[model samples]
Target: VQESEIGTAPDKTSTAFIPKQNEQNVLNDILSSLHLTPMDVYAADNTCAAGSKLTERHTFFPPFLNSSVARTKTLVHISELSKLHSAKRVVSDETFQDLCDSIESTGIYLYTPIYDSVNPRMPLPLRYECRQFPRASGYVEDPATGIAAAALACSLRKHNQRYFETNNDIVPHHEHTNSYDRFEFYQGTAMGRPSKITIRFVENKDQHCDDTTAVKRTTTRMLCSGLV
Candidate 1:
């Protein structure tokens, strides 16, 4: 399942899959212990993988904390946050800002740019996923994403506000104004999003897409003017 379209790909055998033992149990344990599923802790335990030993040396894991944390929100499938579901879940700037903060902690990004801006009837979706692996690792594709640039924009604003107690927040609306036919995200500081990307079925590889090119691609730039 790791290599399939639906799978979280990890070529190396040592990589952590779902947490060991009862994957659901750890989620329940941490969530129940704090009476809240703070995104950072949840993500930490998630990447920790139940069986994987907690190591301070490792890049992903950390030592025990002194106090419990709480988040006043429910975790939803990332798919639920799409434009298609915006009418129902329209997250406010505050929530979106938190999302950006939570995202930076994980170092993953999921960005969907609105394609076909001129025609409302012909809205096209762009899937920006492709990377030329990283140093110390051979060419490989990451399984999860967190749409870095936008998320960072959101996080930077919030973190700045929280840290300095600034009244002037980072304006989410400012991210717009550019014709973003391409997306540069977390796969790497070196990661590159081509003009168009294609995912073929069965085979695990990129098929330079044609349909994407034909469509007038435009991205959805959400401005965090205020709460939802």
Candidate 2:
């Protein structure tokens, strides 16, 4: 596990997070509990551009059965979820249930960046809502999920870079880039077990620079701190 510190003020208290290990085993356990089998798990690719909403669907077969046997289907939707004025009203009842039933899955994870209701253009944090329905376990929503939060941060970083590269007209200079990305996640509010997650990404620029491009081959290091 890796840990880092984050604080807004010099003397104020800071919070940090350490990522968990044995992810594969944990994922398998979650699937098994829902009577679904795990499949080939891979990191999300940078396919969609920044600020673009999209959905990806996948299917997995039961562990003991062949491909022809029953399969579990899951859908993941990425979008800019609505903003909340207060934590007391985190999500609208109709919108929340509609999203939960939109897809059938061992679990459904929806990734969205929460913005300030007063200033819709300004992002307040990132959040993911998890819903699960199984034959034996019934329907339930997870209070918090660390893995899904991390995945969302990764996707945002990739898409942000793509956005800058493609939208040169908006950002004329290469030096002025969205290089430093930070996400603070608020989850479990709907279940009354509110959780906070902070994820930060710092991009490393290549030392050698020509007149062609201000920076090149920018690599990123992600640091996350909070409870899962």
Candidate 3:
């Protein structure tokens, strides 16, 4: 973080960590509970297909499964973070319980870009709903999750690159750039513990074997005001 950007604040502090990158397939087992389908259509069964259709109709892309600094989280993309409340009506208790037992994930992180609500001429940040549902953890959600915010920011960039090759665009034009991107993940509003996490990263592009354009890796660094 640049000193000028942070300003001359004596009270605020910052820290950084290198998050672990891991393969998380738990997304496959708990799809029904999250009311999501596999990213691959061929992997979707009848029930999964129904969930996929629902998300598609609602303008949500399929959930991107990734691991954070602490645990795995299924990142569900929604048009607006506020819509997650209404989603609870469709996600039944029984199915949600089944999801808790079926997977090893710490929780499902619902996220969306708040850009449309802001001026398109300016850069925008993403927000998050870090509702933890680890089996028997007795924790409902988090007040601040800087680590998860870092993970979400990196994964979203990679997700966008993967889609570009196929001409399936979801993210805005600015996000497609290989330059450093900044994101502010606002969470805990539902529980009255409003918190904000900020992250910045740059995608280091690597050419494919076929010489196609793609971003194969990213270096992420998180900066927050006294929030880990």
Candidate 4:
């Protein structure tokens, strides 16, 4: 929030979010619900105002299974999902199986959904459609993600590595971050634009790392903006 960023008194929107009174309790609740803690709550002022979007992170543990530090990659797409309406109904729980399975080994997941359109002026428009299913979602797994960047950087630092491996040759793998963020869908890498940024553990020596390459672009994804 920089003062210089506001020059013409751009219409500002503010909404109060219900904060968690207890962290551990919320975490327990998430586990019970097959959901996760650290969920974001969104809101707005009026019908003319944009609606709020919340991203709820979750985890999944295979029945009778165990591990250390978790082997899963980033499970951050759940909270970024939109209030999807299809010719049918909310995607069947089975439709989410792949997502759930992907996060299975590691036990970490996220669910982000938008209730309104980006303009915040009218009820959010349902634009994206699925060829086989009915829902909208986004996955985050790259350095361009500001919030994940620091965590990713920390992971690199922890493992005594600094290299990331990805299938997208367009990506340089070792990306930098600009700021803390949740806008990954609209983020960029050397491999052109990708919907997801799958991160791999790489070793590095820097105890403290700061990268901002992700923030260099405009995040057009409403999920990133947290505006529905």
Candidate 2 segments exceeding 4 Å error: 1-106, 122-139, 169-180, 205-218
Q: What digit string (tens of lDDT, one per residue) describes model 3 on residues 37-75?
A: 333221112121224432222221233444565556545
Indicate the worst ten consecutive residues by lDDT in candidate 2.
Answer: 58-67
lDDT of 2 at 191: 58
Q: Assess the local accuracy of residue 64 in candidate 1 as a C-alpha lDDT between 0 and 100.
A: 14
lDDT-based ranking: 3, 2, 1, 4
Relative to the unseen true structure, what is the Cα RMSD of model 4? 20.8
lDDT of 1 by residue, 55-96 (tens): 111212111111101111121112112321121213343443
| Clashes found in each candidate (C-alpha, N, C closer than 3 A) | 12, 2, 0, 37
Which candidate number has the best lDDT?
A: 3
Residue 194 lDDT in candidate 1: 27
Candidate 1 stretches greater than 4 Å from native: 1-146, 166-228
Model 4: CA > 4 A from native: 1-97, 101-143, 161-187, 190-228
Candidate with the greatest TM-score versus the true structure: 3
Cα deviation of 80, candidate 2, in Å: 8.8
